[model samples]
Target: MKIRSFFTAILTALFGIFYLPSANAHALYVFAQYDGQVLSGKSYYSDMAPAAATYFEVFRSGIEEPILTGKTDVLGAFNIAVPDAPNTTLKVVVEGEEGHKVSVVADRTMVSNSSNDNFMLLREDIAHLKDKIYLHDILGGIGYIVGIAGLIAWLNSRKIKQGAK
Candidate 1:
């Protein structure tokens, strides 16, 4: 009986861990572009909601210090005039509530080659697809846990029956 209770407790804990909503559910996402003069982008959550008033920092590649810092507007949009640094890559980080944060690297060549509107739309679609994949992975993990738990229970039951015989 004691061993059965212990197994039950372990299985319960495993199920709780797998089913509970995690911080990543509201993961932050930021997308930015450098247009030779200004750096602009939007910050959003996994649910497609805008991450308004989030703090942002812009750093040059390979540099620890941030060259510019600001917060997103009510619409989760921000624009910063980048210094005249030709052929430089910049990293933009956006941090939202509850330590949720994301970053994107942008270069002049990359931005100039893509249309901003279309790129932004594509990015949003990609985010949604990633969220779907994450959910499927979680469900798959839960299935594996259940399968292992069932196998353990079956083995324990068989052991008790053999002992009685």
Candidate 2:
């Protein structure tokens, strides 16, 4: 019986390893920003591979027709100057191979009035803020674990007192 049970557990583990959907892939994403006059961003695959020479289409807000079309450079970067765009937002669509297309939108809100050289510094600041928030979330999760453990201890103590009575 013991050997049979061990064999059964091994088979279950093997089946779980083979049949379960455990493989995870990072999702493809794009981020674009406007620098008062130009829109620019990089295109990348889920695996952090550069999407070189990818064709992109730009559409204005609520416009069915694309206003501009272009291709990325070897570095997977594209920049377009829209000095007189009437709309406040621009959408960039990258048509990737294997039907892995992605779209990103650039808005006027990202266009700071500061000097052009400050953009990289500003991006770093935003990244730091994200890190702080992530840290805060991790601390909150620890607090929740402690709270649940305390509750369980209190419940067990109450049960012990009833047994003593």
Candidate 3:
């Protein structure tokens, strides 16, 4: 026991001294848009080796502070809704496993969009409502009840099979 403790202490000290910290450089994304335009944002982590978990962060340019940061949902998209836009840049950053990643995200692709550009209507003033629909709003109370019942039935069937085995 004494020898084991001594060897463990020596190994720990050696590792602490020899382990070099890696500082990977990542580029910031810059976006341009017209003033007074409400912007919708969506981002996902891309380019990582197999068996590695994907992690990312989205932020505004210049200040280096994050506007939104989180794990992606079922759609693998972290969506953000901005109130206004003018000379703003949206940033996307992805890091993997203590930043020792197989693919280094050290570049940017710039895409320009005019905020005043109308999707459908010719005039920009009528851009507020452009074919928008919510799933919850459409489904209503009956839809929710049916969805719950289906989920319960599926779970119970799975549990029953497990028990049979």
Candidate 4:
């Protein structure tokens, strides 16, 4: 019984991962903004994004990893900035609940940059990784465990019926 429950949990987790794939890839977004650079983050959305993603990530222009990543506030927007955009492309990467990654860009220059960069860093952004695990794989192999468990349960029922007969 314990093993059976474990397998069920695994199956549920796996289904969750494969559940959505369309929003995984991103094209790009172009919007109007002042020529002035502001560390202030802009509102973004995954509305048309894949069903699996829960939040967006903002990656600084040259940084290998994202400077920050997280779910948006009620507005589906995040405000952030690197030390300066400096006539460079600012990257905003969106990560989904299911582990999909996508990015957008915001360009800016030093002359018009915002007054405060620290105001947006109230707390650091965290990555979502729980979606990667599938417990179903551990309870047993997909074919062997599920098939054997079903057969055993059936056989036990048959034997009980014969005894009654």
Candidate 5:
């Protein structure tokens, strides 16, 4: 019985060790828009937490050189005045200190909105939407949970049967 309890504790600890990293892990995402002249936006993690003080780089599409570099404010907000170039493609990259990086591409249509209010409305629209959720992925996770529970139950039943024998 003591050996079983010890093994159970070890198994639980091992499971925790393997699960904690992914469970706590966050994927970074940056969303930016240019309202005709000023490019501005925010960076956030998977949990919708602000990615504050992160460095951001702006690049022209198909150009290897960064056009501008800036850092987010305390609220994860950033703004930079851009040229009045219409139909330009811009790429924005936000880098986190923990080696996490997220990039977003903005085309003319994205930033050509006349006012900041329009840009902000677009941001709010995106913010309200949920991230992509695949049906198969969810089903697979459910299957894994059910399988693990069944295996544990089977092992317990086997122990009971053996003890009765």
Candidate 6:
């Protein structure tokens, strides 16, 4: 009985450690908008840190090679003059350190007619939303921990019963 309890405890601890969220949750994000002439956007990590000096590539739809390549500024921002290719989609990919990467798609219609102020406001709203950790996320983690603990307990009980026979 004592050995079973110890094993159960160890299994629970391992599951808890593995399932709990960490700082590096692989939540890299890239957002971009095209305003007729220029394409601009930002790249950020889950903690809202700027992915400064990160390499970025822009590829047109149906093209295998990148049409433009550059690095983000200190604020995780980039701007490039997009060739006037109407009705074509452009994909912006940002690659950060430690294998972190993300992509966003932009077309001529994204911000071509919108005002600059509106675009900034939309960007700020998106960034704020991305930084949030919802209550459901916490509850889901707890549920996983509980479920793993219950499974470990059940398996331990079955092993003890089999040993008795």
Q: What is the lDDT of residue 19 in candidate 2?
A: 71
What tens digits encode model 1's per-residue C-alpha lDDT throughout 1-165? 976896788787656656664523567877777877788888888767889999999999778999999999997988789876865789998889998878889645354555677866676566556544465676787679769878998999999999999
Each prediction's TM-score versus the true structure: 0.64, 0.54, 0.29, 0.34, 0.63, 0.70
CA lDDT of 155 in candidate 3? 100
lDDT of 5: 0.75
Better of 2 and 4 by lDDT: 2
Clashes of 1: 0
lDDT of 4 by residue, 1-165 (tens): 987888788777666547754524333221212234343343332233223324665565566876665665553445443454455565665554434545546545335245433333331121112222245654456668668878998999999999999
| Tens-place lDDT digits, model 3, residues 48-96 | 1122234555556576776654443443323334444456565555444
The local distance difference test score of model 1 is: 0.78
Which of the predicted structures, 5 or 6, would earn the higher lDDT when compared with the native? 6
Candidate 2's error at 121, in angstroms? 7.7
Q: Give the per-residue lDDT of model 2 (tens digit) for 37-146.
A: 78777676654566788898888887899888999898677788866566467888888766768887874545556675467446534533443324366457657865
| Residue pairs with backbone overlap in model 6 | none
Q: Encode model 5's per-residue lDDT on 1-165: one tens digit a residue.
A: 965885687677557645664564567877777656778788877666788999999997677999899999987888899786656778899998689998988534344435567666677457535543345765677678668877998999999999999
* Model 1 lDDT, residue 141, Cα: 78
Clashing pairs in 3: none
Residue pairs clashing, model 2: none
Candidates' RMSD to native: 5.2, 8.3, 20.1, 14.2, 7.0, 4.8
Rank candidates by lDDT, best first: 6, 1, 5, 2, 4, 3
lDDT of 4 at 48: 30
* Native-structure RMSD, model 4: 14.2
What is the lDDT of every predicted structure here?
Answer: 0.78, 0.69, 0.40, 0.48, 0.75, 0.79
* Models ranked on TM-score: 6, 1, 5, 2, 4, 3
Q: How far out, in Å, is residue 77 in model 6?
A: 0.8
